[model samples]
Structure formats: structure tokens, C-alpha cells
Target chain A: MKRVNILLGGPKSEYPDELSKSIKGIPGPWVGADRGSLYLLEQGIIPDIAIGDFDSINKKEQRLLKDNIADFKKFPPEKDDTDSELCLLAAREKYNAQEYYVYGATGGRIDHFLVNLFLPFDPRFLDFYDKLYYKSATNTIRFCKPGRYKIYHENGMKYIAFVNLGPVTHLNIYDAKYKLKDFNAGHPVSWASNEFLNETIDFGFESGIVAIIQSKD
Target chain B: MKRVNILLGGPKSEYPDELSKSIKGIPGPWVGADRGSLYLLEQGIIPDIAIGDFDSINKKEQRLLKDNIADFKKFPPEKDDTDSELCLLAAREKYNAQEYYVYGATGGRIDHFLVNLFLPFDPRFLDFYDKLYYKSATNTIRFCKPGRYKIYHENGMKYIAFVNLGPVTHLNIYDAKYKLKDFNAGHPVSWASNEFLNETIDFGFESGIVAIIQSKD
Candidate 1:
């Protein structure tokens, strides 16, 4: 299975220290969205594809990105999709990766965060909902369709949350500190701050998408 | 109309400079949740009530809260509801305010943020959905039920977003940079980064709740 990592234009402080190590260890293409290209360049890593409107970067940074990155796609500032969405679409179409790790998508404007978080709900990206994973300094978020799944606890992640992004039915959770069975929700709800009972936990839902977020305090 | 502001344990950096001014200008009572009680005290504003598990603050700070606040409600750390929820519940039952402004509830753990954002969906808080407002440094978020509403532009807010928290029908947007007419959404979707055409814009939905977010870049 192919894996690709895309970075957006969120605050630098939100990036985990392990991001650089992961970039070096993972053998996959790196796509930079808007100012994220400048961020990657600052880290001494040239992105495989730099895509965005380039509004956030200065002239010198844009020149640097153009000089170093071979594939740079620039769009107009006034566009329908956000820079992050455009970059994700480009990565999806070009790489067709089975898995996508998104960085720099959180800890910024609430609207931007919401747009990124609900991207999978859009018709253009709905099919790949399960493939997208959002990573920040303190959290890792994943979306799941209606199905049974086992989740392994991460080393430092103390809390796990199951949030229904829409209407959901018959949700079941097992082997967790707080267990739920045959739950139904009419709208978005976050059952947050749950802990794992063991190394792994099991959960399933009958319908709707569930966002499973693992985070530290 | 009575208005009460609730502050949560989110990071202090997310608080706007105008927070203190608003806290002073508004005459309504203030409620602090967990470490937020300490934050309120740091601002030299004595909260009317402090409610939480008191896990995030030191013993000294807890003592300060106990000493200063008239109503102090402490719960065990391992409780069903979060500190923010507990505080809101207490405020709702006691004050029965018509409007609520939430601060220090953004820019922290993603799970906590999600939990706070989706609080209106909880059955306990569902009746007062329209009464809640979340404020951060760069954003003001409000929820609305099925009704027509006129939104006047805030002085510094540059963009407006309409987000369907659930399945929405017959959503209409008028006098905005990007207008929508009778649009229906099957799931949660963020129509973000839209601008206003004039001093006020109009929007309405036939069904479901919509979150209108006004933000600055």
C-alpha cells in the first residue's frame, strides 16, 4: 500500500518533534500546501510537490520554492477550495495512495480546522475518508465508516475520543475504560476523554462516520 | 437579556485581548471550569462559581479558587461529564440565562475542543443550543436552529462560514460574497471562508442546526 504525507499552513508550534524523524524514516512523497512548502524548506526537506496560492509566503520564499521543488502548482487567491483541500486533491489524484497522513491541518483558525476535519464529508473526498489521518503535536485523528475495528493504544496517548460527525446508530465500544452499546445519536456528538483498558480496544457502528481522536493532555 | 460567560481550561494564548474588557463591561456572572478558575483569578476577576475536578491546577491555585469564589463545586476526576460541561450545567440550572458566551474553550487538546464544540448536541444542553456562543482570539461561533436570521458584520471579522452540524435542508444564503440558494447537505459540511457583501447578510435553513462562524485571518 502506498502512503503519502501532506503538510498545510498551520502554526509551527503545533508540529510534533517527531515530524522530521517521520519524514526521514518514511519512504514516500511529501506534498506541501501553501505556506507548508516554506515550512518544509525550513526543515531542510524539499517537498515532492508544492501546491497552494502562495499568498502566505513572501516573494523570496516563493522563489526558493520554485527554484527547489520541481512540481509547484499555484492557484488564484480567490478560489472555492482551501489551499489544504487543493493540495490534498492534487496528492490524491497524482499519488492515488492508500493512506494519507496530514500534518499542519490543526491548531489554527477554527474554520480552517473545521474545513479540514470535515473534508471527508465532501462528495469529492468521501470515498477516501478512511485513508486520511490528521496528526498534530498532541493529537492523532482518524475517520471510520460503519464497521468493526480494533484500535491499539499509542505510547503516549492517554485519551481516546469517538466523535460522530453526523447522525449515527447502533454504536458499540468494548475493552475501553468507558464502554457504550447500541447507542444512537441524531447529530454530532463527541464521547471524549476515554482511556484504553488494555493494549487494544474494539469499537463498531452501524451507520455514519466516526472520528476517533487519540490525544495527550 | 441575561448573559453569562463560562471559561474553560483551554490554553490561555487563545484568549483575546478584549476578553478582560468584555468581562468588565458585561454585568452577568462568570463561571470557571477547572483550571479556568485560576485563569479568571489571574485576571483579577473573581468568578461567581468555580466548577470542575480541580486536576489541572495546583493545590495553591485550588485554594485560591476556594477562597475567592463564592460557589465551588468539585467532582471526582473520573466523572462522566467534562469540567466544561459540568460548569455549563451548573450555570444553566442556576442562572437560566438567555445567552452564554464561552471563552478559554479553544486551542488545546483536539478532543477537548471537539467535546466543547459538540456540547450543544448533548441532550442535557440541546434546549439552549441557540443561546451558546464560543469565542476565541480570531473567531466567534454561534449556533442557530431552523429560522431566518440577519447577521450584521463584526468590525474586524473578515470571513463568515456556514457549517451544517447535521443533515440540513433548504439552506439559503443571501447578500454574501458566495450565495447559496436552497442547498441541501446530507451530512456535516463547512462552507468556509466566505465574505460579506454589505454590513449585514441573511441566511436561513428549513431544518437542522447551522453554525455560523465569523473569523479573522
Candidate 2:
């Protein structure tokens, strides 16, 4: 299993301990982007691949990263993709990994956070979204294609929101809080925050993609 | 200038400061959406219209809002539009305000924030996108249609990213940190955080709707 880990510029310290406890069992070759590099360093971990223009980190920290990390790829100051995204592209090359777990990815500025969430929608990564998993302090989110998914729960999140990630034409929630039958949640009204009724429930959608956000508070 | 002020939830204490600052020297009716009502109260200011399901605010706060505000309209929990959206709809009917300024909208949940940024794509507000302006602490963003625009800057930000908010055929940047000549920044490699070079700059495109984010680190 070629496992790949990508960390974006987020409030990693706030989510570090939580993620460490949860992701300890998952194996991977970690990659860092911008501030995400500094975050991993603070935790005494070195990234295998570091990609960015090096704006977020100071010169001394950049030197430390250069000396410690195995490979560092620097793009010009101007680029089409976000630094975090560039890291993902590099990640694809290195990891034949079956699963992808992203950290330091949630919270901080809303714009950056949203970009990462919608990134999976990119045609390049859309095919692999089902294998992707992301964990913030109080939420664990992932996208599921047309299939039956078994969600394993940790105690942090109280509610589970089944956002159509994109608009699903006919979405049916077999087991969840606020069940819907053949639902078409259009553009404006995305299922904002819905609760999960039971501990472990079965959910399978027939046609479209669904983003599952298991959140607390 | 038919100025309209729409207050939505953000930081509680900063709400008043932002509200007072955003509404200063503006002549128009004010509108609040969902918890936006409570946000105005946090600053000791109330809007003319209270729209949407007051679910974000507690029962006590809702009661206080109803007692103090005369035009309070509540929707069912299950509705087609998000709360902030309903306020804009109501504002169109009641105020007929052409230019809308959304206050205290950034620095929140990523999902809510993204929806707000793309609010222009909503069929209800699609035609009026040019009249919209979104402000964050370090950035003032505007979504524009294709052609060209001249931006005036009092101070320079470290970064300014212009993304094809919707898919664009061809985009050309005359002067920028990474100036481009008739480049195709299609869907996947969407323009992300990029820096600025001078105090004043010009930009134009061949086609498509674009989001101009004049931002910083």
C-alpha cells in the first residue's frame, strides 16, 4: 500500500495531537506545503517531499527544511496552482499509495480551506476522491462515490452531514439524521449541518458523489 | 447609489466595529440574515429586515430579536436557500438596493464561506454580481465578467490572485507578479494566491467570469 500524506497551511498545532492519536495506525510518506512544513518540524517530524515557493516560512526554517528533507521542489513565485495543491501533484508521483490522509487542512482562512475541500472536484483528483480522507480537530471528512460505505466513528463528532459534495440528481440517505428520499439539494441549499442518528449506520447512494462530514459541535 | 448592507454572522465583538465601519457614509436600508440578527445585537445595532429561520440563535435571543425588531420574518428549517441568501432576496424586494455590501462574512466555517463567495452564481443574484463587493481583513475581492479592469491600490498586498471563478476560455494578464500573455488558466489549475508588483495595475481577459482576490499572507 503506497500511502501518501499531504499537509496544507493550517492551524496544525490545534489539530496535531488529535490527528496523531487518530492517524498513528495509518502508514505513509508525508509531504508538506508552506506553513505545513513548519508545523511538521515543530512536531519533530520531517517531510519526505516539500513543495512551495517558501513564502510562509522564514529563511532559517527554510534552510532547516532543505537540510533535513529528502527532496524539495520550488516553483517560481507565480504559479497557477496553490502551494498545497502543487504538493498534491507531487504526492501523486511519489505514492502509489492506496489511501490519502490530509492534515493541517481545515480551519484558518475560509478561502484557503474551501479551495482544499473543492480540490477533490478537480478532474485530475476526482477519480481518487473516494480514497481520500481528511481530519480536522473536530471533523473527519471524505467523499464517497456510488457505493455502500461503512463509516467508522471516533467519539469526537456528534453530527454527520451528507453534503452532496456536488449536486446529486437523486440522493437517498438510507441511514442518517434527517433522512431524505430521492433528494435533489440544489446549489444554494447544501445540507449545511445534519446530525447522525445512530453510532454505526449503513449508507449507500445510487448515482452521485456525497461528501461525508462527521463533525462535533 | 442604492447601497444595501447585509449583516451575517462572524466574530461577535468585531461585529459592531465592522458593522459601524461598513455602514458609515452609506445611504440605504439595512438587512440581517438568520444569526445575522444576533450579530447586529452584539454590536447594539439592528437591521431593517430580519430574514430566514433563526435557528443559529438560541430561543432567548430569538425572542429578544422578535421583541425588539418590527419586521421579523422566519422560514421553516427546511428551505431552499441559506439564511444570508434569503436576506439578499428580501433586500431586493424591500430596499431595491443595487449595490450590496456583506459584513462580518469571512473567518467562519469553510463551507458557509465558500457558498457566500459564489453567491453570485445563484440564479437569484446572478445578474447583480457586478454590484457586489466582499471584504476581509486583508483583502477586498470582486468577481468580474470578462473584458478588462483597472485597479487602484493605496498600499500593495504581498499577494493577489485572479481566478476564473467559472471556466474561462482564455485569460491574459498585462501586469502582475507573474504576468501572463494570453494564458489558459482553465478549471483544474485555477489561479490561487499570487503576489502583486506595483501600486496600480491593469488586467483583462478574453472570456469567462473571474474572481479577483487582492490578498496577502
Candidate 1, residues B105-210: lDDT per residue as tens digits?
8887888888887776677887787888888888889889898999989879999999887889999998799999999877888889899998899999999878
TM-score, candidate 1, chain B alone: 0.95
Which regions in candidate 1 have their CA more than 4 angstroms from the true location?
A: A20-27, B20-27
What is the Å distance of residue A112 in model 1 from its true position?
A: 1.4
Off by over 4 Å in 2: A12-29, A72-76, A79-81, A106-115, A121-129, A138-141, A144-191, A194-217, B11-29, B154-156, B179-189, B197-208
Tell me each candidate's TM-score: 0.95, 0.78
Residue range B1-217, candidate 2, lDDT tens digits: 4788887665442233344565445556667877777766665676788887877778999898898788999899777566777777777777666788776565444345555666765678766777776655555567777788886563544556666654465677777667767765333223555555666668887766677766554
Error of 1 at B29 (Å): 2.3
Across all candidates, the chain A TM-score values are 0.95, 0.87
Residues A43-109, model 2: lDDT tens digits: 6777888888887678898898888888988777657677767877778767756888888776544
In terms of lDDT, the poorest run of 10 residues in model 2 chain A is A184-193
DockQ of candidate model 1: 0.72
Question: Which whole-number lDDT from 0 to 100 does residue A190 have in model 1?
Answer: 86
